[model samples]
Structures are given as C-alpha cells and as structure tokens.
Target: MVRAPCCEKMGLKKGPWTPEEDKILISHIQKYGHSNWRALPKQAGLLRCGKSCRLRWINYLRPDIKRGNFTEEEEKTIIKLHEMLGNRWSAIAAKLPGRTDNEIKNVWHTHLKKKIKQKQDSNNQQLYVTVPKCDDLSVIDLSESDNSIIPALPGLIGSPGHSPMSPQPSSSDLSTVTETSGATAETDNIKVEKMDSSDMFFPLLDQDLWSEAELAENSSMELASDSMVAAGFYSNFPRIDDDNDMDFWYNLFVKAGDIEELL
Candidate 1:
C-alpha cells in the first residue's frame, strides 16, 4: 500500500515557523485541544501541513517538553536501548521523559554514532598491534601488557563471575533481614496505645457532662444573684464542688483557651 507524502502538492508552508505562526497554533491548541492532525492546519489558521503542526507541537511548543542538551543518564539510556533496539527512536524516546523521537534520531546521527565508531576503531587498532608468533602461548607474560588490550564490551557487565560490582548479599545479611521482619511482626501484636486528655491537649467533654456543668453554673449564678456576688466572683470561684460530681467539663473550664486554639 502506498502512503501519501506529508505535504503532497498542497501549497503548504515549510521550513522554520515564524513567532506569529507559533502563537496562533499554540492559541488554537490551548482553546480546543488537538484531536485530528489532518484537520488541525485548517482550524489553526496556518499554511503549514498537518504533519508540520504536529511536529511543532510535539517537539517544541508543548508545555512539558524538555529543552537544552541531553543529560548523561539520557545519553547512556539511548546507547543501551540502541544496542538492544537499534534505530527505533520512538521506542527509545518513550523511555526518556520529555524527549521526542526526532531529537534522539538527530543526536544519534550527528554525534553519538561517530563517537562510538571512533572508540571502536581505536580499540581495534590496539588489539591488532604487532606481537611475535610463538607455538607456546602460555610463555607470553600478558599480565604486564593488560592495558594494550581492548576491554570487554560493557553490555556483559552484570553476568555471573564477570562483573566488578558487589556480590549478591551474604547469608548473614539474609539472616539480618529475617530478624528485622520478625521484629516488625512482633510489633503488630502490641496493643494500641491509649491517649489521655493531656495527650490530646483538650478535655473530651461528652454531652451529659456539658449539660451537668451548665446546669450547675446556672444554679450557682441564680443563688448568688439574691446575695449580689461581686464582678470578679466567678473568676476567683472554687470550682471543685464535690468529688462525686467533678467531671470532664471542669477540666474544659480550666483549659478552654487551648481547646479554642485547637478549634
């Protein structure tokens, strides 16, 4: 099956877009959002092809797009992914956040590919250096000439017995992990710690306690009314009336400011 050329014979603008064109495309996208690229150019009021508009938005105009040079981590990811999935830039871009496939392709072709080739060539030259032919290969002291050889490809780094990285956790470390897990399980069996008024910093007065306190205070006010208690009387009043009736609200009266702050 044949696919149509992106722009075809349509009189569409090409090459770099102007600032005004960028603004119009951005405004159109912000207002309606991009759903159909084939119909976007007409709606966006641009002479560019749908493909051009899509590329512009995806590579540059998108708000979340990352600009500037590729990071070291990104470079390593690209190289490793290329070794596994060669030239599949879209797949490579999917692994790297905010990077477009087109940008990755350009970077590989323009820079990274050449650098890899040069290194490979240098290693090849070093490995092919002149050495005297000998029937007894064991007699050659290769220990002193180690740096003249090319290092093995880093792709084989983590294989068994070949890696320079730390070995797998020892039996002692595994035992320590088991002990820690056992301690955590034992902790789960412990009873939940109870909180008191001091811990809460607020007196937990139930409805019954609040009503009883209001009634007592009202009775006290009424009794003192006949005798005309002074203005500062309630402020200086002895609140612990009886051990039997002393309740949660009495504590609330003393620490009302703290409770107010909490509220």
Candidate 2:
C-alpha cells in the first residue's frame, strides 16, 4: 500500500500555524516570492502543506481580504444563487465580493437549511378558522352593504390582478366563490386580516400557527373591538373580530417596506 506523506517528510506544518509561523511565511514570500507553493513551504521554514499555506494566505491572510458576516439580503441572494446552482460554492463565492467558497458552503448548509425547514413547516400549518358543524350552514350573516356582494371571501378576491373569485373570468362571475358543491371546487379560500399595529415588525406566519383556515374566520368586528394584545393568536387568539376586518391591501405595502431596507 502507498503510504501518505508525513508532515515531517513533506516539510509541512504538523499543527495550526501561529503568529510566528505567519511572520515566517510572510517574510519568506516577500523576499523570494511564491511562484511555486509546493517548493516554497520547506524553503520558507514552514511545516504546512504548500496547498494549505496557499489557501490560508489567499482566503484569510491576504492583504486585500475582507472578513465579516454577510447581510440579510446577501444571505437571501446566496440562497437564490445556490438554488439555481447547487453546490457550486466557488461560483457563489465569486458573486460575493469578499466571501470565500468554504464560508458560503457552511452558511448554505447551516443557515439556508434552517430557513427552508421553517418555510416548509409554515406551509404545513392550517390558516383558516374552521366553522364548526353546529354553526348554521344555511347562510352566513351579511351587512346591508355586503348583502348584495358575495358571501365568501375567496369568491371576492385573489392574488393581485388575477381573479381567483371569478366564476369564468366574467364581471358577474367575479363575486361568487361561495357557490359551492360544483364540479370544480378550488383550494381553500381563506382570508386572514392581520391587525398588526406595529409598523416595522411582524413575525413570519406559517400554516402551522396561522393556517389558511384560521385566517378565513377573521371578521372585521374582531379588528374593531380590539387592536392591541400581548398574547399569541394560536393559544385560542389575541383578540376577536366579529365581522369585517381591516383591508389586507396595505399588508403588501408593509411587507415591502420591511424588505426595502435590506436592499
């Protein structure tokens, strides 16, 4: 069997390099220049492999090296890049000005993995509030203004621009998602109106804690009755809205504002 070369035989560092070791490597390189790292280690009086010494100098000890944690946006961009480009750490690192491939890989495995796991967990949560079987299924209550409008929330709106509520993309079909027991019933149409009083803060809501079902049961009356509470919503709730909640139209604006600073 071929034996691996020993540090002593290879004339490389047997342990971690110290300040004294660094000074020696730096002085030798400055005077002789390191055109060939494999030959330089032994000649420079160092016991580290030529490749190891080269990586240390280039990644951390280089004159132009920058060291620090990546910002939140940087992290997100890294995740996007990683998703598109697998474990091409060197390529991902190049996009980042001062980051190294090893560093990016570590963050991808540690931080990115955690965020993806949380996102998956959130997707599993039920956001809607289930109408108990006992509630009169005949006709849910409606106000004088809402009497003419559709009864279901999903029968009214969808992601901005598109019509998730429309019957057949027609103006008349626009207000009737509540017309149930049909050939093609869509996914749960739950509306969750978050009465967030804080302008700058709102934790990530997942399906587990803030499921689509729970959000649908939110009523405007609950929003008007109370706006502030210290408790969480899942423990039966923060406060209740009888009917009619604040318009979630501005919720997108709030979320956009939160990410704007990161850029």
Best by TM-score: 1
Cα lDDT of candidate 2 equals: 0.48
How well does each candidate superpose onto the true structure, as a TM-score? 0.49, 0.46
Q: Give the per-residue lDDT digits (tens) of candidate 1, residues 1-263.
A: 89878785567899998999999999999998999887898998899889999999999999988888998778767776775567789999999989999999999898877765554444333322122222232322222443223112121212233211122333322111011122343222111112121222222233343333444566543333221121111322223334322332222232211211111
Clashes of 2: 29
Superpose all Cα atoms of candidate 1 onto the true structure and report the RMSD in Å to 1 decimal: 31.7
* Model 2 lowest lDDT segment of ten: 224-233
What overall lDDT goes with each candidate model? 0.51, 0.48
Candidate 2 local lDDT, 142-261, one digit each (tens): 222221221234333433443211122444322212334442433332232211123112233432554434444554323311111111223333221222222332132122122212
Cα displacement (Å) at residue 103, model 2: 1.3
